[model samples]
Target: MYFTDRGIEELTARRGDESVTLEWVSDQLRTFVDLHPEFETPVERLASWLARLDDDELDDE
Candidate 1:
């Protein structure tokens, strides 16, 4: 598994039962970026990916 999979697994194991909204997730991402400026680019990319998860254009890239 990829190194990032551990964090994904941990997130799933910890909050698997929780139901969250996109707004909530977006807010959390923003807060995380505020606290971790070094992760700004990755967070922005993640947020964009999440926001366009269903977009066909993303598949072409």
Candidate 2:
């Protein structure tokens, strides 16, 4: 498994039962980037990919 999987697993284990809105997630990402500026590029890519999750073009990646 990828190293990131550990964090993903932790998140799932901690909040799997909770329901969250896209707005809430966006706000959280923004807050995270504010506190961790070095992650700006990766966070931007994640937000963009999330915004286009339903698009077929990104499937090529």
Candidate 3:
């Protein structure tokens, strides 16, 4: 399994039952990036991808 899957699993186990809004998630990502600048690019990409996830083109990726 991919190493990142462990973190994903942990998140699921920890907070999967909670309800969250997109704004909450966006704020969290921004806070994370503020604390961990090195991950800004990846976080930005994820945020952008999520923002445009409904677009037909990204489905192909």
Candidate 4:
């Protein structure tokens, strides 16, 4: 498994039952970027991917 999977698993385990809005997630991402500029690119990519997820699924139909 990828090393990043550990963090993903932890996130799932810790917050799996919580429901959050995209706005909140976006705010958190921005806050994270503010604290860790070095992760800006990956975070940007992740945000873009998330923003396009529904459109991407539409393409499969």
Cα RMSD for candidates in order:
1.1, 0.9, 1.1, 2.5
**Per-residue C-alpha lDDT of model 1 across residues 1-61, encoded as one tens digit per residue:** 9999999999999999999998899889989989999999999888888889899998999
Note the Cα lDDT for every prediction shown.
0.92, 0.97, 0.94, 0.94
> Where does model 4 exceed 4 Å of error?
56-61
Which is the leading candidate under lDDT?
Answer: 2
TM-score of 3: 0.90
lDDT score, residue 14, model 3? 100
Q: Which ranges of candidate 3 are over 4 A from the true structure?
A: none
Best by the TM-score measure: 2
Q: Candidate 2 vs candidate 4: which has greater lDDT?
A: 2
User: Model 2: per-residue lDDT, tens digit, 3-61?
Assistant: 99999999999999999999999999999999999999999999998899999997888
lDDT of 2 at 45: 98
- What is the C-alpha lDDT profile of model 4 across 1-61, one tens digit per residue? 9999999999999999999999999999999999999999999999988788779674886
Report the poorest 10 consecutive residues by lDDT, candidate 1: 44-53
Winner on lDDT between 1 and 4 is: 4
- Extract clashing residue pairs from model 4: none
Estimate TM-scores for all models.
Answer: 0.89, 0.92, 0.90, 0.87
